[model samples]
Target: MTTSESRDEAVGSGDVDFDHHSLTFRDHPHEALAELRSRGPVLHSSAHDGFWVLTDYASVFEAAKDDARFSSAESVGIPASGMPFPILPIESDPPQTQQLRAITMTPFSPGTVKSLQPDMREIATELIDAFIERGECDLVQELTTPLPARLMLRMLGFDESTWRSWVERVHLVIHDRAHDLDAAMTAAGSLLTELGTEMERRREAAPTSDLYARIVHGSVDGVPLDDVQITMYGFLMMLGGMDTTSGLTSNSLLQLCVQPNLRQRLIDDRSLLPAATEEFLRHDTPTLGLARTVTEDATMAGQSLKAGERALLMWAGANRDPAVFENPDEIDFDRENKRHLAFGVGKHRCLGSNLAREMFKVMIDEILTRLPDFRLAGEPVRFSDAGEVHALRHLPVIFTPGPRRK
Candidate 1:
């Protein structure tokens, strides 16, 4: 067979046409990714709106690290122009990006995250307690969705009463492309303005120990942050802490429920939570891939990319590339060199990765301890669009409640 034919056979599955698939790439893009990896570490696909999708782990890592050559200034999603606003740090490159990331990362350091562990566990338990008696509950709604939102609100000093509205606004911003971008942008802008005002009010009244205060008064390079910067940081933090954690928690729970043997093993040995979390991230990262523009003409994996052309660093595809990960399809909790690009790589690696890991660790530990026998209610599954992030619109499950503690 010709090289192209072999590559096509490896990546192609009759379930979905790579040429026509949009929004929802395929029922199983991972299978296609594996096939592509076999044919060549990197191959341009008709997918991703005809832009090059990098499927090899090493090349994806290289692209993520070589930010000078590949710029992140473009829109993250398709259609390019309609995104409401540039996701600060994420959409920025170089000096400005570095400064913003430094400011944001300060409040999310390992110590700060560790300090919040007790609070996170308390929140998880409180949510779990509410539903434990029912013996059957949708873990996504009951636990996964609220835990991160509540944590972020508390961190930012926002009222819990407004969590639902904020969640809806973020969802609309991220998922509802049908809605007018102007309207969504206006709504998000107004919401952040309100948040900023509230933050300023809190600062004037009495300095409070919270992320909002830190940002409102914090400085980068001897210059304090302005209202706009503070607002952008607040909105970005809220969205980042909310959606990604929710998606990860829901996805991990689904995996546990479906794999009874794995679930039992985890329950028997709680120490496995951290490794299991890493494996889950490697297996199915929430954010699929990140985009970057070629700053200068460059060759990648033997293909020439022109200046100003866009390329996708497929994190999900990379994590599953057999070239770096042996038996990439399987979820091996004990896999050595568990350095997965689920958190991206280089300067743009997620600042909240530590917090995310902690959140997942706490929630998974609590769930396995309290609901060891948790099982799916009926084919507990995920949404159709597994593109940007592998999220579950709904994850229904049934579990035998654990023994009541004194």
Candidate 2:
């Protein structure tokens, strides 16, 4: 309850001292996950007020599919405290979650993301340009934080001027352990206010084509969405579409920074970009896990569970499950089994996967192309909380100062 994970106490049938929310868990996620995977697929953690961990790939996947058994209504994250509201699409079940997803796709669809590529590239260039001549910069601050934030703001049809403020609040709420619940709610409230006002404004009149407009007027299969319902989409926009992708990009770059050989391969041949991104996602999953409330009594992998039990599908651990993946410990772009649940699986899979994947490609493409020789300037400052999302707080890198791209 206090720490994300402290010492072990016994819980359900599968007793394991695993806590994804813990500083200890974040510090050595692989070792901890390995222990859980070895011991039990359905592990009961006496941490964060006792929850089960679905460490094995099969168990997690099966449970992900059985929506009735494993519902998303409780909490998507292991609440350090409590959130005022549940994030839309994520916390909602099918029909509603699926319906909101239908509207959400309009903004992030393949063509939409493709059309924005020039802008994305330009923004990437601009950010790198600022630090390219300095020989060194905090990649997390200089690049990672802003790229996805700017893009997300554009997607949600927000004014560009407020990007930094939103980004700051997002980082504080998500990556900062000290302000997890309060800051998350405060930031969520702030966005809800702005998004609500804008949504109402759009509903009144004088509308243009933007993601916000579509959602405000969105009716899935003819059922209309209301204002409060629409604003919940805003909540999802702020939480799902922003810092999570930032974490993905930052973690990918950090991988390249440390592994010079892996860095060089992608730089030499851009064809490797897509697969490479997958490997990076697999290696350092941005989303550590997702939470589900067990709604009915069930047996998973032969283990029985009661209704109302909380289970965390440890995606990071599942991605690294030795049974499914060969040499799971090694980071291999060419690794044959690239099926990672980094972006979750089943009905509740990440709605922003297209955007996330493309952003990772561009971010990595730009970094390797521009700062080919950049290496870690210092040790990375990782997030204190690694339960919901495993993220990098700061990553300093140094390279030969290069001329700015025209």
Candidate 3:
């Protein structure tokens, strides 16, 4: 058989070995991906225990777009034991996915998020105030984590009382092993069930202008969304909004802190914040990659992939692909044409991307204006193990507390 045919058969059968590579690919994934991209864009690998990884920009993007050709129904990587429900729209497709997106999109629109900006700014400033007083703080805990959680809670009309528990549950759910997975999943499910019931009650008794009420009572094609769908969507929104943005924020700050010159530049000229955000995202995409199962035999970069095989669309690798990005390793804040897959590509692109960009803009603008010369107090811990989300576990920084003007 031809090389392409062999690779195709491997991918089609979900027969790639995943154990050869290191757990996180922390040292040099870009270089490895580049080698794969050059040799064969869609090569099969039985690494990381066993899973097919699709490396390269064009092929990964193509796989992501053609959902029909690459199904998401199968257990992608390792399933969380005892979690009966599939992880929202991420694990779903077509009509159901579209319906869920429509309902969830209402609260995350530009207008809705823009309206919440003032409140977000206030919260950001409050956190900054505390950090400034201390002169040193952990950015992840003090700033990044809380900001997004608060925004998500407010958007969903959920009580702040449960925020800590919910956030903890999510972190554990994502990071913990199979033994702890059941408890984590149970906590998340129970929390959502309560929230869903409360949402339904509010919808019936006094429909509010909040997102929860809207989704609980909303309809698509004259069909009202069921409780499970609403709850799942809410869970997704909460998870998506909190973790990814928090990761982005912490990663951005970590990058800025490490690169003193960039920090000074942003301090001197706040106009570079937008470009800086893009650079940070491209350099360290929050979500690493998404998984897909091949549905039929197909050719990718001259390699034929067969039916019912699993493959990972490496967004992180694609973002760093030299063919698409100039000087992919260098962090160019002033990049003229930034087209990174930090938020993904194609139809399943992150729906909250616009909101995420705006959030970063606002948060970064506030930080530049306040703590301009922030420096790292210690080494930042990168969360490289969360299969798809890349983030920093802790980012300790020291800075002169800027005066609270606002």
- Judging by lDDT against the true structure, name the best candidate: 2
Ranking by lDDT: 2, 1, 3
TM-score of each: 0.88, 0.93, 0.89
Sliding window of 10 residues with minimal summed lDDT for model 3: 13-22
Q: How far does residue 124 in candidate 1 sit from its true spot (Å)? A: 1.1
Q: Which digits, one per residue and each the tens of the lDDT, describe model 3 over residues 259-324?
A: 878878887888887788888888878776777877876666665666776678888888888888
Q: What is the C-alpha RMSD of each candidate to the true structure, in Å?
A: 4.8, 4.3, 3.3
Question: Could you tell me the lDDT of residue 30 within candidate 2?
Answer: 83
Query: How would you encode candidate 1's per-residue C-alpha lDDT over 47-108 as one tens digit per residue?
Result: 54556667788889888898888788776554353544566667778777788787657668
Off by over 4 Å in 3: 1-23, 26-39, 47-49, 73-82, 177-180
Which residue runs of candidate 2 sit more than 4 Å off their true CA positions?
1-13, 176-180
Give Cα distance to truth, residue 110, candidate 3, Å: 2.2
Candidate 2 residue pairs that clash: none
Q: Write the per-residue lDDT of candidate 2 for residues 1-406, one digit (tens) a residue.
A: 1112222322445677665667888788888988888887877767777777888898888878878778886667665325556667788787567777887676778888788888789889999999999999998888887888888878667886578888766665666533356676687677778888988788788877878888888887787887677887776777776678778888878767767788888878899888888888898888888888888666665455667778888888888999999999888988988889988888888888888888888888888888889888898998788766778879998999999986
Candidate 1: lDDT over CA atoms?
0.74
lDDT of each: 0.74, 0.79, 0.72
Question: What local lDDT does model 1 show for residue 177?
Answer: 36
